[model samples]
Target: MRVAILASGNGTNFEALTKHFQSGDIPGDEVLLFCNHPDAPVMKRAERLGVPHESFTVKECGGKEKYEQRLLKLLKQYKVDIIALAGYLRVVGPTILNEYPDSILNLHPALLPSYPGLNSIQRAFDDYKKGKIKETGVTVHFIDAHLDHGPIIAQKAVPIKADDTEASLESRVHDTEHVLFPAALKKVILERMNKQ
Candidate 1:
């Protein structure tokens, strides 16, 4: 499979995906990294990993339509088969989503139908404080137009510890993501890979 990672944060998950797709169990022909934020730490990780990366935000491209047009052009140029959204903060527009369809996968920090948006880990911890839940988990889902509301590919729960801080819980969740994402992606890729 030819894979590309779209991310916006510190790039730990981006790094994880790049490395995992390059070798280990499920290898790919090439793995690329693209970011909306040019200066995000993930760009640095991309440089360190020797992965080719491209950058341009919606504002940089002038608007959503233009931005997605540029993104679509790039994806076509690379012949990307799978788009893994690791930590990308932006909601993918219809253009790219329509182009890629089920080929795009989103990694979220909390189980679906629970904390679906930003600060999910913090929200889960807060809910625990409120005695509303006992555990939260990571989810790898096929993204649609909605935010983190898509068909689930895989999920793994992480129990809340009484002594655990929100930061600690986030750490554990990230660790789980690193494990779950690649495994789920391997399945998705092999299952959906276009037949020659």
Candidate 2:
């Protein structure tokens, strides 16, 4: 299936997904990268990986509806069947959500139903520092209109060590994310293929 990735910052997850698909670890067709920030590093990564990419600002499109309309148009042009949100900061509107439905997935740093929004890794680490929680991990789920409130497809927890700092915990969580995101996508792909 054709896959598109949306990213806003450092595209480590984007790079991981590209590499996974390149290595035949996951079944997907050409990947197109989309970035909200024109100067985002993800564009560079996409170029390096030889993937098609586009950068746009919501303001430039006049409004969310127009921006989403443009994005939807692009996805349709590529015949994209799946979308991955990797560190993509903007909340997805119904335009794309309705078009893709459960086909769009996002990877969050902390296990969902625990920390559900931005700065999740840092927040979870802070909670651990305060002895409020013992562990945190990553979650992969469908993208809904709600922020990080979609149905979870997969999750893996990582225990926080007493000596773990926020940075260390975050590193481990990122590692978990790299592994889990592709696995989750693979499951989604297999299910879609089976349904067809």
| Poorest stretch of ten by lDDT in candidate 1 | 22-31
Query: What lDDT does candidate 2 reach at residue 20?
Result: 87
Candidate 1 residue runs with Cα over 4 Å from true position: 194-196
Judged by lDDT against the true structure, how good is candidate 1? 0.89
Model 2 lDDT tens row, 1-196 = 8899999999999998889899898886756899999999889999999999998999999989999999899999989999999999999998889899888999988878888887898898889888899999999999888889888999999999988888888898888888999899988998888888
Local accuracy of candidate 1 as per-residue lDDT tens digits, 1-196 = 7888899979988777767766777666545789999999989999988999999889988999999999999998999988999899999999999998888999999989798888999999999999999999999999998888888999999999999999899999999999999889888887876553
lDDT value for candidate 2?
0.90
Model 2 root-mean-square deviation: 1.0
Worst 10 residues of 2 by lDDT: 23-32
TM-scores, all candidates, are 0.96, 0.97
Which stretches of model 2 miss by more than 4 angstroms?
A: none
Pairs that collide, model 2: none
